[model samples]
Target: MSTTRTHPVAGRATEVPPRSRTSPPSRRRSSRTRDRLAAAAFLTPLLAYLALFYAFPLFRNLDLSVRGYTVRNFVQGGAPFIGFDNYVKVFTSQTFVPALTHTAVFTLVSIAFQFAVGLALAVFFHSSFRLSATLRALFLVPWLLPLIVSASTWSWMLNSDSGVVNSLLRAVGVDPVNWLTDPNMALVSVLVANIWIGIPFNLVILYSGLQNIPKDLYEAAALDGATAWQTFWRVTFPLLRPVSAIVILLGLVYTLKVFDIIWIMTRGGPAGSSTTLATWTYQLGFGSLLPNFGPAAAVGNILIVLALLAGLAYIRLQRRQEA
Candidate 1:
């Protein structure tokens, strides 16, 4: 009788509204939103840094490219609005074509030498041999060495006289050649140094790629009566496709932009034979008496365009790999 006196809603267990079931989903959405906000906050500094350092400098360089009616005056900070004259100077100058050709040659030769040496080193170190790890660690030391020290060492070794390399050559009854003095050989000498520096990096990256390959693939191939060469070609090569593309592309871009080795070894010397586009730009921008900044900036812009193209290509390759 007392229960019957209660309201219908109070008498029955209260039926929760169907919308209440969505509360947990709302909370989860809020959590996801908070996480996204936190991630954006974390990324803000990096974005800001790129905008400030990279974007700002690029614009400033471009501004310099279009300014100053004559190359003679920017050295003194006078005049403005020159149109494309400086760019034309860079394109029409005698040094420009040779610098372009030399840079292209340097990139090709260095990439080839680096790939060959690095592949050999990577394969050698990949073997299950004692001291392999230690040798790898030693190899990386060259890359880890300070750039100035590396360049200085090469400069001394390639010195015409009183250098150990020349002394060794002389002792072997070979002529003591002017490694840096001969314009023909100066670029080659710089290439040698750069190749030495590059080999370790290629070795590291390629070795990592080789390691990531499942051993089972080799084993399965072996069971199928496949030769080691066949296994590498079929299984290893296919597996390493992505890594190989990355190595080649990155190497191309890096070798194309090389400046330090040329700078420190020969200082783009021996009648400017060793001067690549980058070194030539440096010469025009700051090294020469006239200091043609606008033309130098134009050359720099060309390099940046190449770098951007390489970057975009890499991105496409990576996307394809991921897909």
Candidate 2:
């Protein structure tokens, strides 16, 4: 496939080979195929992890909720399908209202106090004093401690009789308060411990957010003679909105599922006075000799729905802000 052509200027014959029209398109197609294969290779592990850990467990939980599972049937694998009867039982139970109320109160109060204290500490440390870093590290002890250790420590510290808290109160000429034994105070006791454990996390996050804010804004506010409170409200809080949103959202999810701390401290005790949906779920599932697996699954599903709704609400709020 050669052709003779005349060179325009030299008036000489030259052999010009013909070009293949299909070469570039075939190379492009091959490159695209390789790129797709590489992308698939990169995504395989993550996909596999989600499928194995998340998707399968969620599906299994859903299946458990729909079936009338008992100890005998749970192992033998012949539980009868019971539609939404478990959910109905959970809804009609006397414990449901109290558990829901406790969960709401515990989650909200804990978040509020945690955020307030953490933000105050973050602002304090942002000023860069000589001992700021050391003190900040000290504050992280609560957050870094193992949950079991933290719960046990709080339990001992809030003991009805010989606790340090009661001793201090007595020294101050105040009556010794029964922190754990009193049903009215049990939730408060756990809430205080939870708040303490959560504060450092919020401080760390908010401090990072504060660091990202432009220093010039603070300088400008100072030059304009704005008070500390004014500067925080105007210059700091607005800039910190995104971090705050994420912190609150994550805290909500974590608090909703909190069982170990409450369980370890009080076993949701004092006749189920401090029981939350999380603890109630355990009580229904495994805390008794005769376990109600389906009802437990339903309670867990309700928690999942609440968390999902909160996530959707956050997304909607973010969209509105962005718009």
Candidate 3:
């Protein structure tokens, strides 16, 4: 005899249909297709932007770098294909070595001092105190102002003759020092200005990172009889590494491309003492009557490489921390 099975519904037995093995896979495939379409729709704008603004410009610049692009090319709408001749010219140029060295020094010194000052301020503000918020807001003024304005203000302050810095030094019985005129001092002056502008950015980021850290960790450190400095080094600093790495990488990229402060203060002057690769590119492209667009593009590509390496480093660090 054959047996029959039924499912109960509303206190009555009803015949039920057998399950189909094919249904679930078909449903899942449709759901996945819908999800993929949704994702692609959301990402389309951003992808388009990157392709239009970033990727296209980068490739166009690369093409220009390999060709004899110049002001004449701008007029005639045609450029000769030179195939890395611009790169050769840039490497062989007298300004290349000094500009490269200045770029390195400026980036390193600005990042180091900015991080140190910013970290100190972040730690100080991390503790509850009166007027702390007000003070921190005040600190942001330098960073908040437009770069041109900040650079101009610094130029006035650091003026060799009648500037406030010189006035103060004179009042203290020291002879007025040439901050912008001396080749030895121009780069240092630019560094000082850049550091000042950069500190608030670092402080804001580091302070936010400090806030995210668990209070329980500090309590645990205290229970372990760790001194404040020991607790900071062992507990806080280690936890802060990821944020610090990000901050440093961002700072490095910003510093590498710094132009406004140096340009306003000295125009990379005093015998090209403060000329970074960025400014050198500017000089090649616009400073002279004959614009060397090819070499300028080559220099720009060099900066892009450095930035890309820094970005890669940041990605690697993040992955390692996640692992």
**Which model scores highest in lDDT?**
2
lDDT of 1 at 116: 76
Query: How does model 3 score by TM-score?
Result: 0.91
Q: Please, what are the lDDT tens digits per residue for candidate 3 over residues 146-200?
A: 9999999999999987899999999999999899999999999999999999999
Candidate 1 C-alpha lDDT tens digits along 1-323: 11224457767554443444558889999999999999999999999999999999999899888886255565466768888988899999999988998898889889888887887788677778988898899999989998788989998998899878999999999999899999879988998899999999889998999899888988899999999789878997788788878898989988888888889899888898899999988998889666778888899998988888888988998898899
TM-score-better candidate, 1 vs 2: 2
Residue 246's lDDT within candidate 1 is 83
Task: Candidate 3: list runs displaced more than 4 Å.
Answer: 1-22, 319-323
Model 2, global lDDT:
0.94
lDDT of each: 0.86, 0.94, 0.93
The worst-scoring run of ten residues by lDDT in candidate 3 lies at 1-10
Candidate 1 wrong stretches, greater than 4 Å:
1-33, 69-79, 316-323
Winner of 1 and 3 under TM-score: 3
Best by TM-score: 2
Return the TM-score for each candidate structure: 0.86, 0.93, 0.91
